[model samples]
Target: MEVGFLGLGIMGKAMSMNLLKNGFKVTVWNRTLSKCNELVAHGASIGKTPAEVINKCKVTIAMLSDPAAALSVVLDKDGVLEQICGGKGYIDMSTVDPETSCKINEAITSKGGQFLEAPVSGSKQPAETGQLVILAAGDKALYEAAIPAFDILGKKSFFLGQVGNGAKMKLVVNMIMGSMMNAFSEGLTLADRSGLNPRDLLDVLDLGAIANPMFKGKGPAMLQNNYSPAFPLKHQQKDMRLALALGDENSVPMPVAAASNEAFKKARSMGLGDMDFSAVFETLKVLKHSS
Candidate 1:
C-alpha cells in the first residue's frame, strides 16, 4: 500500500524506513527537507508540503516530536487539511496530550479524513526493530485499516476506543517510565556513593521482580555517560508535563510524576535536553550532599 509519512526525526525515519524495507510505497515530508534525503536513498518519495503528501496517498502517518509540531503540520498553511478528504486516513503516532489528539481528530474528521491517534511505547532500539508497542484510538475503522502498516511498525497495537484515549495512555505510560527512571537513578547514585558498584546493583535489579528491558538496555550506556539521543530528555519532560496536566484536569495528584518532571527539568537546564532521557542520571550524580 502507498503511505505518506511526516516528521523524519529519529523515530519517524526508522518507522518510514521499515515501511520502505517492507516494500510499501512511502512518500515523506519533513520541515527540514534535507532530512528526506536518507529516506529517498532507500526508495521513498518526497513531498514538498504536508498537503502534497496527503493528496498523493490514501494513508498518511506522522510521528512528530510534540503536540505543537503535530498541530502545525496539520493546521498550518499548506497543511494536511488542505488535501484531506473522504477515503483518506491520518494517523498521528506522536506522544501528545489527549486534548491535542482531540483537536487533531476534530480537524481531520471535519475535513472528511479518518483520524487515529497511535502513540507508541519503546525507544530507539525498539523502533528500529519494529518491536514497539502501539497504543491506538480514534476511528476504529481507520485503526483496522492501518493494521498492516502498524504491524510492520510495532509488535503490538491496541485500539483504545476514542480519539483521546491513545494519547492519555501514552502519557500515563511515559509518566510511570519517567518516575521509574528517576528512582533507578537514585539507586545507582546511592549505591556508588556508598561504595557499592553500580554495575553490581544493576545485576541485582536484573535478577529481581522489577527486571525489565529499560533498565537493562540503558544501565550500561548511562554508566559510561553515553547521552546519545534516542528519546530525548526534553521530549520526556514534555510528556511528564502533559501527563501532570492530565492529572490536574482529572483532580488526580501525581506526586511521583511531578517529582520526576522536576528531575527532568533539572537535566534539561544542564544542557542535557538533547541527550537521552536517561541523561537525567547526570542530575542526580552531580548533586552535592554529605553522607
Candidate 2:
C-alpha cells in the first residue's frame, strides 16, 4: 500500500517508520524538513508541502501535535484542502478536541475529501511497537479503506460514530490517564516520605486488581527520576484542559480531572513540561519535602 504521512514528531516518526518496515511505500512531510531525513534514509519519500503529499497519495494520514498545527497544515497555503478531492482519504490521528476534529472534517468533506478523526492512545513505546489503540470516527468508508494501514499502526482500532466521537473518546481516555498518573505520583511520594520503599509500592500495585501497564511501565522510571519524554507533560496538560472543556460542554463535573490538570500545570511551571508526564512525581516530591 502507498500512503502519505504528515508531521514527523515522536509519534508520527515511529508510525511512518512502521509503515515503511511493514513494506508500505510512504511519503512524509514535516514543517521542519530536516526531520524527514531519518525517514528518508529508511526509504520514505518526502513532500515539501501537505498539498504535495495529498496530491500523490490516495490516503494521507496526519499525526500532528495539537489542534493549531492540525488546522494550519490543512488550511494554510499549500495545505491539504488545496489538493483534497473525491476518493482522497485523510486520517487525522492528532489528539485534538472534538470541535477541532469536526472543523477539519467539515472542511475536508466540503472539498470532496473523506475525513476520519483517529486520535491514538498509547505512548512512545506503544507507538514504536504498533501497540497503540486507535479511536476512529467519521466517514466509515474511509475507516474501512484505511484499515490496511491502521492495522499496521494500531493494535486495535474502534470505529466510533461521527467526526467528533473519536476526539471525545481520546480526550476521555487521556483525562483518566492523567488522573491516574497524578494519583500514582501522590502514592509514590507518600510512600517515600513515610520511609517506605516506593519500589515496594509499585510491586504491590502490580500484584493487585488495579494493576495496569502504565504503572508497571512507568513506575520504576518515575522512582529513578527518569522523565524522558515518552508522552510530554505539556501534551498531557493540553489533553487535560481539552477534556475539562469537554466536560463543561456536556454539563458533566470532572473534579478529579480538574485537580490533575492543576498538578500538570504546576509541573509545567517548574519547567518539567518537556519531560515525561510522570515528572509530576517531581512536583509532588518537592511539595512534600518543602512541607
Candidate 3:
C-alpha cells in the first residue's frame, strides 16, 4: 500500500520508518524538510507539502504534536483539505480533544474524504518496536482500510465507533498517566526526604499489585535524574489542559488531573518542558526545598 505520512516528530518518524521497513511505499512531509532526511535514506519518498502527500496516497496518516498542529496541517493553505477528495483517507493519530477531532472530521468528510481519528498509547520505545496500542474512530471503512498499516504500527487497534471517541480515549488515558506520574513523583520525593533508599522503593513497587511497565521502565533512570525527551513535558501538560477542558464541558470535577496539570505547568516554568514528562519529578523535588 502507498501511504502518506505527515509530521516527522519523534513518533511520526518512527511510525513512517516502520511502514517503509515493512514494504509499504511511503511518502513523507514535515514542516522542517530536514527532519525527513533520515526517512528518505530509508527508502521513503518525500512530499513538499501536505496537499502533495494527500494527493499522492490512498491513505495519509498524521501524528502531530497537538490539536493546533493537527488542525493547521489540514485547514491551512496547501493543507490536506486542498487535496482530500473521494477515495482518499486521512488518519490523525495525534492526541487532541474530541472537538478538534470532530472539526477535522466534518471538514474532511465534507470534501468527500474519509477521516479517522486514531490516537495511540506508548512513547518512544513502544513506537519504535511497534508495540503501541491504537485507539481509532471515525469512518469504519477507513478504519478497515487502514488495518494493514495499523497492524504494522501498533500491537493492537481498537475501533471506537465515532470521530471523537478516539480523542476522548486518548485524553482519558493521558490524564490517568499524568496523574499517576504525579503521585509517583510525590512518593519518590517522600521516600528520599525520609532517608529511604529510592531504589528499594522501586523494588517494592515492582513487587506490589500496582506494578506497571511505566514505573518499571522509568523508575531507575528517574532516580538518577535522567530527564530525557521520550515524551516531552510540555506535550503532557497540553494533554492535561485539554483533558481538564473536557471535564469542564461535561461538568465533571477532575481535581487530581487538575493538580497534576499544575505540577506539569510548574515543570514547564522551571525549564523542563523539553524533557520527558517524568521531569515533573524534578519539580516536586524543588517544591520540597521551597516549602
Compute each candidate's TM-score over C-alphas.
0.98, 0.99, 0.99
Best model number under lDDT? 3
**For residues 1-291, what per-residue lDDT tens digits would candidate 3 score against the true structure?**
999999999999999999999999999999999999999999999999999999999999999999999999999999999999999999999999999999999999999999999999999888999999999999999999999999999999999997899999999999999999999999999999999998999999999999999999999989989988889999999999999999999999999999999999999999999999999999877878888
Candidate 3 deviant stretches above 4 angstroms: none
Report the lDDT tens digits of candidate 2 across residue range 1-291: 899999988899999999999999999999999999999999999999999999999999999989999999999999999999998999999999998999999999999999999999998988999999999999999999999988998999999998899999999999999999999999998898899999999999999999999999999988788988999999999999999999999999999999999999999999998999999888887887788
Per-residue lDDT tens digits for candidate 1, residues 1-291, read: 999999999999999999999999999999999999999999999999999999999999999999999999999999999999999999999999998999999999998999999999988888899999999999999999999999999999999998899999999999999999999999999899899999999999999999998899899999998988999999999999999999999999989999999999999999999999999999876784422
lDDT of 2 at 186: 90
Note the Cα lDDT for every prediction shown: 0.95, 0.95, 0.95
Model 1: CA > 4 A from native: 289-291
Lowest-scoring 10 consecutive residues by lDDT in candidate 1? 282-291
**Count of steric clashes across candidates, in order:** 0, 0, 0
Model 2: lDDT of residue 157 = 94
Give the candidates in order of lDDT, highest first: 3, 2, 1
